[model samples]
Target chain A: MSYCVNCGVELEQSLGQCPLCNTPVINPREAVCNKSPFPEEKGQVEVVKRKDMSILLTTVMVSTSIVCGLLNVLVYSSRPWSLAVIGACILLWVILIPIAIYTRLSVYTSVLLDGLGTVIYLYMLTFLSESSQWFWGIGMPIAVLVTLVTEFLVVCFQMLPRSFLTNTLYSFTSLAALNIGMEILIDRYLQGTVQLGWSTIVLTVCIIVNITIITLLSRKRLRNAVRKRLHF
Target chain B: MAKREKPIPRKDWYQLDLSAIVYPTLHRHDFAPVYRQSVLLTEVVDPELLQRAVDLTMPRFPTYKVAMRKGLFWRYLEPNDRPGPFVQPDIKNPCQPMYFKGNNRYLIRFYYYRNRISLEAHHSLGDGTGCMCVLQTVTAVYLRLKGYPVETAFSKEQGYFVMNIDKQPDPEELEDAYMKYANAKFCPPRPGEKTYRIRGTKESFYTLNIIDGIMSTSAVLAVAKGYHATITEYLNAVLLYALLKKQESDRRLRLKPVKVAMPVNLRRFFPSKTLRNFITMIYPGVDPRLGEYTFEEIVTQVHNDMRYHINEKFLRGDITTNAATKRHPLIRIVTLFIKDFVIKLFYTRVQDHNSSAGLTNMGALKVPESMKPYIVRFDIYMGQPFSSRTNCAIISYEDTLTINFASSIIEADVERYFFRKLVQDGIHVKIESNREMTLEV
Candidate 1:
């Protein structure tokens, strides 16, 4: 018999490491046997593969798009409504391809892929509609702005130290900023002027909420009171 | 000469009891509402004989052979024709959701490894007491099949009392005792305080670490007697005390209530032999926000609470409140899908927040005297805790009381602290784990 150097508990000859501390037994006389007291097969669980799930999802999406495209062309035979189905297929591919292929892709890479996919899918829709002018003027700017704001918020959430109140504050502030940017883009595109309308009211309320949260966080008594009231 | 064989009759389906309704609805992929009970024998298990025993014993447990099906108003249990899953050498974790769609399988499974014969049953079929009855009967049948001179006279029934296998199964065994006994009065729900939950890095691959601490029943009984407490009360105090010590090291958890949900066997209080989940939970512990409490104080509080609340009247009132809610006209009219959604929401939002850990003591296991020589001991392992990281169960057979701690987390601090406390109090504990750690290193 050997003993764990760290925990000082007796170790069985079959166990190479201490069951409690994982300290390797150093005794040369007692050779560790590979067999375990419990069956080896029982220790493992059959975890469902994410890749398999992704493949199944891809199959379903492709099959639906194909069937719809075929029905549109064969049954109607007037307009190329199949193009709309094809555009949807492109969007689905863009959203699901990265998730399916690269399971361990970084968060930043995933967000960037998603943004690129959205832009490409919108471009496909514009090309099919023969509305490149509107796409360049309206759709591209909105999609770019939305993607940038989303990526920024995702980065903030991933990198920043987070608590319930702080997370809520950050999300509200980001949402308010995104709303303001979207309104400015929409106003400039629609009327050739950059003026805010309902966004200012939302922004003001968001600012007040953030300020209240900041105050509560800074004051220990107020923070405890809020926590108690919210039951967080 | 030609002989004619009798055609076997089809079995009829039965409706799920009121207490069993929540189990099927709340069961999810990660959390399967199943529990396991095992009996250790002196000799290694024979797979073929065990299968034969299961085949013979399945008919005896009529309620247990049913499969769950969704009806318009509620989920019901249908009698399944397919045989129970073969007594395989256990190759997967215990109680890992035996129920699946399109499998034509029953809710219970039998597995044997070396000297251990384990039965994992979905809680929807029956409670621990009911499962124990099936296990004891199966063991008796297996011993008899093995040509051991075992008496086949004891009747195998649903309830824990009366181990006689000669009598026919009583129809009362399948009765919804909760509905039958509950007085139709809606009592207001009691408010519950949140308890401190043990947090740790969950074990990879969703594996549970089960550590069985086998000790002498006399030693534990002596300690409990000294404190003027019952075994359950003493064990609850020790578990709480362990949690308290762990909580002290973490400043954030120091003020939380260290409550343990004790499952009270309703059969002891009510005169019912039904095998369904006839149990209620009683949360007993110390509120750490009040102040630091000694071990003695904790025991006294637990003992007092148990003595006061474990009576027939109190349990009847608790069941009545539950039954009244289920029997409410509006609730009964609601479709099963909506009811399932509400139950799932209630389970997570309300019930999960109330208790930190659960302790279920199946108490002592009994077997026919003739079959006792082949059996070494028995163990009861509650599946991983619903919301907490750890749960404990205890069952004593003969002189040995085995305390099984099943945890989803990697840290064994609570078990270590608990067993060490027992050791300090002059009780010897022999530890046996599933040995998952050996593979890790």
Candidate 2:
């Protein structure tokens, strides 16, 4: 018998407040009790957790490292070849820790840590090999370039308004930059000068695709047509 | 000693119908295509009596009594053969996700709270019409159990409103009607353009916020007549208009077509007594990018567009296209895992994006005169869709038409706009909801 003062809509007897507006229904003539159309306990579906997967993966990594370390000590003590297996496990753990173990860690931090772990693993290889030159010259820079490119892609995807066109633009542009950057790092490390060879063709193709995407974004009719065609 | 009874020869397995084939792949832990129909009675419900009534009515709906099973190439339905879903106390969240492992392998759930007896059915089993029939039959049986004299006699001259409980289910009731009616050779191109979606803060736990607008059926019909449109057309127009206004108020400059998807019941067009999934969606809308529209223009556009697509010819195209796609050699040869992935992709990318919102009208409900006195009103609820922020279901009893908006978002702007439009048109709307209105975005 009461109407919402703000919405001007009639309120049901069981409701203590207006559903459209949050105005409290203070009808002096009527008293509301514990009657409602819906019950009190709202059921929620259980959220699937990655804790089990994390445990399983951790067990595998730890067990493999242990078995290899044991064999290296008892059987092959001279070479200490298990370090390579241990280093590989460390790199894998670094990549999977953010994905499976501590998922709350931000993507930028995860990528940076992964790059740092790879550089450290390369340094470990310096002990087994003859020279520590490649670790600093080529390996570190390439890993850093890849990590930065991935971080940039993630930031653009998260911040930008997402669509098929924008996602494609971000991906191809990043791929082109990463491809050319890897070539330059390799050339600089080996030939003492940067020379782009295979990456030039890839850069050219990426530019054409980027220009086509920009053109589609500027025009409305073409964008709609592309959307329709790409649908499912 | 009791005499041994004969075992009936019945189907224990069935392939999912054309419309239903998509639901199994698209369902998740939080979202499934579940439809609910609840009837409010004059007296509070008795659980024991309701349970017995459900048991009595199960033989009449054989298809609804099964569970989803994964086959090698596709998922199918097999007889659940378990007791439940046991009639239990109703929860605030109706039509939540249904899992085959739990729920006694039953795809349908029955709940009672206060004076309402609700039935939630997985869309893989049936549409609104199927759920409506189940609820009506269960209610009739429940009344009978409560010492009310409700008729259950079947007759050809006077067709029964509530299905006769004693009679065995007709084979036609369990039929996959799409296969019988679809002409695979006459497939039509898929219809739908990516439309404007209502944006808002989604509920974190995926609880469906329902608001029921109860109004006089005749009053709303009279208003629709004023616009020279049917009730469905008028309501679709109102929803689109609301979305348009919401977009303008939000100051969204780049506009898309504000379309409302209406799930047309196929039983009305075909002589099928199916209780399985048999419905197709039709989108009627206005392109705001074209210009601003008055209410009259929206109504006219919705009317013509709905009428144009709701015909037998147009609907058959949808059936045929679906049937043809399923029958393709590649689709049939793929393993179940591959099929699930492809269909899930299609459902999320194409199907969910095609409509901004949905409004399904279960139309008028009829009951035997003897049973009508005990019933107060009926409410139908479309489950919250995966992407659409809001969905509406309408059903009318004697005079009251209940428009239930099941929303997944935190804001009430769409429901507010819809009911306010009706109230402004001189149709009185009494608003009720499942929860307190506290959150705003």
Candidate 3:
């Protein structure tokens, strides 16, 4: 195939010139013809898919959840409350499905589904007649801690550059800062006093150390990237 | 006849000692003010015939004969018992015959190696366009000497020179007036002051390439056909594109400003021409981040950017005017010294930040082609380089366009990439190599 000399693009048929770039074309087979390896194709049509992957995701997610649940209940259970637990789990799932499907917001609907399951389990707890005070303080704090850990970890994973120690330091500093603010609020509302403690000091130290490491790493990155970045 | 003029004393801005360092070719990137390499294609013509060529080239460049006397800069050529730069001396400095050096270590090296020829003026004198007329006239004189059918045109050009007139700067209107009136800290460089000896060759010099090309007068006109831009704009675009490609890879700079420092003819800007350095450097800068520029686009930008600076606003003696009292010659002199010397450094820095290098289009050289016996090439250098920066020049002779890239640059790749990209863009670029380039030893 021949191409345009001025703006390289393939010529059509045995035509003397390229239709696209509109320059005179010389056949590659000819002795005098000069051509570059890759022709600059202007305005040629090509495939552009809006979405690339869809079906593969659904099967993997459904299978993983089912397998994890079954293994935990059947093979790993050491206590005798298996039947009660399995029945409660099925009941919770049946109640949550309708809320998940009907709600307009993905976030709100997921929250509502979790709420329904929590309510079901709480009703079952009432039947057990355990002390309610423990639930208010211990269970609630542990639950909040777990959720915060999960969300913070996910964000740190997405934001920080792909370095294991860097991401760990980033998360540690972020969590420490978060808890310090929480501590101040808690002390103000509950104790009605300003107080400093060992944990607070430790958290502050972690914040500083993490920040220093990140700053050093950032500087190194900049130094290496200077020629690429600085025009002068 | 125009008013009779006096030969005012011209001041030297910098001094050079050539013994410390020498680069063989005009292509070296170093600043070599003392020993510049030149090639003389002597067309053994009689002095009388060469005189005729001077007549023809001058109607095109009659402006050069005027004696320049700058009111602001105070740089004018004064009468002496010697020829300037063209004087030949015996013994030690072979070029001293062609050079004129007196009390000041400042010497000029001119070429008339053979009989009659034209001296290619360095950028320090004027841009290519300004010098072309002078050169062409000189070439005509040489052709006439050689019995070539050269035109005997008496050029009516009144060279850009100011004569023996009492010209003084306007008084300055500084707001801090009396606050610092009795006391200002720094002393400016005195006129005709020379810098300290580059402490034993204070500078290292080298030239990587020196080249010349010629374009058909019609082809140059074709570049300006629709836009009405000058051929300088066209050649400037080619250099600008080469530079933009060189620096485009730098990621640190948010955006690089590509500037072409073009010297505008002050004769047209102002009615004055008798002053040396009458040409003011104007920078036409563009942000390369704009992307995918066509040669035509750069040409248009260069056209507007240059036109703006040479416009009436800057020329009306507004920014350049001073109000120093005539009675206090000291105050006036000091004020003028500060204005001329201090501001130039600032302008140079601004230009560096805004440009990769410089591209000076002197316009077309109009020498009758017959004089040089099939003119081989035409080239121009700035006579010196910036302290650390580099610059490029493009001179078109007839059918060929010669692009010269000079540097004192640390990064060799800037020139390398620029030339590579330029050749790729369809300009037939020939670099002056050490062995390949034939220069005066």
Candidate 4:
């Protein structure tokens, strides 16, 4: 019998390597591998199919929109309230179509598609209301700002070096920044001024907290102290 | 030719034990509380004989034939008349969810491989010891039916390492030992210490990869003696050391203590022989906050902890506290849905966070002298870890100790490191894994 060189114990004749250390056997005389105790066929996992789920979702969205549109035409015969349902159905399709078709889409592509879908849905609402002026002035700007801020936060959080504390700090700071930008956009569009109110306080507090975290992280001693105390 | 008709008998039902109540409530798509015990024989398994064996053995172990049912205040077990799943050829992963989409006839299933007969049991039905006893009975009956001339003098009383077959099962086997023995003295909970969790890419299909390292028991015991520690303590130290090595490579892991939750079989401490869930867990490890600990130091600490914590008094207090919480009058009145929600929440938040990985030592498998030569080895595979992806179970028979490392992750660093350390400590391990060598993690 060959012995495992690493563990200095006798190796079974059937073993290909040292079971404890996984060190490959190197003996010329004992090169024959023994049959494994496990089954020859590898175990196959039964994966739940998502295609059926996607089909169900698509059917529900399409039917609801279609039924609402028909009822609005035949029963009420009033305003085209079905336009809202149709727009929502289109938005849902735009959001879910890519996910259903390509299960492994990158985060960047998903965020972009979601942002574009929201903007198109808002435009649809503006078109139905017969008021295109405010679409460019308020709705477009708000949607664009929200989408851009979301994309920025997603990319930053994913790309930047992360620790638990730093990640929390980054998320809060991004939130505060997005809130300030949204307030500015709203004020400029609605009141024709770049006035900041509650957002200023939020931004100031977030910046102070970010600075404190940055200082603590930069110093090894302080970071260790905080980690030990917080137990994160 | 006319088929004989057997009259259907009235079904029997039983209440869920204190420890078993958590299983049916927390069972989900991903988390299936099932454990498997298998015996390898010299000859291939006969499906027809095995089915007959199961039919004969079911009457002996009454609890194995029941299905879990939801009750108004608590979940209970009801006798199911549906025939147990036939002894099908082993396929699919080891421990798939027992409660399938529409099938919940029985909580245990019997399957046959080339030369292995396995029994997968839901934790609600019984613990590893109970499952092993059932498997042993089945094997014995199978061999007898196969004309092997196996001895059939099985006892009715449940005892450690004894196969109780061919006789009536004792009612004590179904007793809720925890509730019966619980002394409500308000013992404080054990210290809650966060451990260094092993993180890796989980298997894409959520399949478990089991690596069974067959080693000589005497060699391992010799090494354990060299370290002046028991086999369990020695292996726990090795596992902790492996985790520490992984932490050394990945700086992202918190420098918490690398602890392994060692499950203590209560049969050793208590006189009860009930096969239901009756074990408790104890966390033993070295606190990294106290600075780097040598292998010797870690083993010493583990040995001391196991020695102190596995006593009858300490285990009594531990189980009493657990049973007392479940035995609360207010908790008894809560609706089943609310109770399930509360237990699920407590399980994920509090219980799941207590340990990084579990190492269950099933000790040894004993059989009648006549059937010993027909058997090759015994193995135990604990279900996938609740929170972590990897957990370990050990079963020894004769001179061979089969340590099965079951992981849902694609990484083998922990297993590799642990095995290599054992080799370095002068123990030879013959490694066998289901993973292809080219795809080694």
Give the TM-score (0 to 1) of chain B in model 3.
Answer: 0.57
How displaced is residue B193 in candidate 3, in Å? 28
TM-score of each: 0.79, 0.77, 0.42, 0.73
Error of 4 at B118 (Å): 3.4
**Positional deviation of A212 in candidate 4, in angstroms?**
3.4
> Per-residue lDDT for B433 in model 3?
18
lDDT of 2: 0.85
Q: Identify the runs in model 2 with alpha carbons over 4 angstroms from their true place.
A: A46-232, B1-8, B155-161, B439-441
lDDT of 4 by residue, B304-341 (tens): 98988999899888888888778789999999999999
DockQ of each: 0.21, 0.34, 0.01, 0.15
Residue A212, model 3: lDDT of 69
Steric clash pairs (candidate 2): none
Given candidate 4, what's the lDDT at residue B137?
Answer: 79
Q: Give the C-alpha miss distance for residue B260 in model 4, angstroms.
A: 4.3
lDDT score, candidate 1, position B332: 94
Task: Name the better of 2 and 3 by TM-score.
Answer: 2
Clashing pairs for predicted structure model 1, backbone only: B154-B164, B154-B165, B155-B164, B155-B165, B155-B166, B156-B165
What is the CA-based DockQ of model 1? 0.21
Q: What is the TM-score of chain A alone in each candidate?
A: 0.74, 0.81, 0.40, 0.79
Which pairs clash in model 4? A19-B429, A19-B431, A20-B419
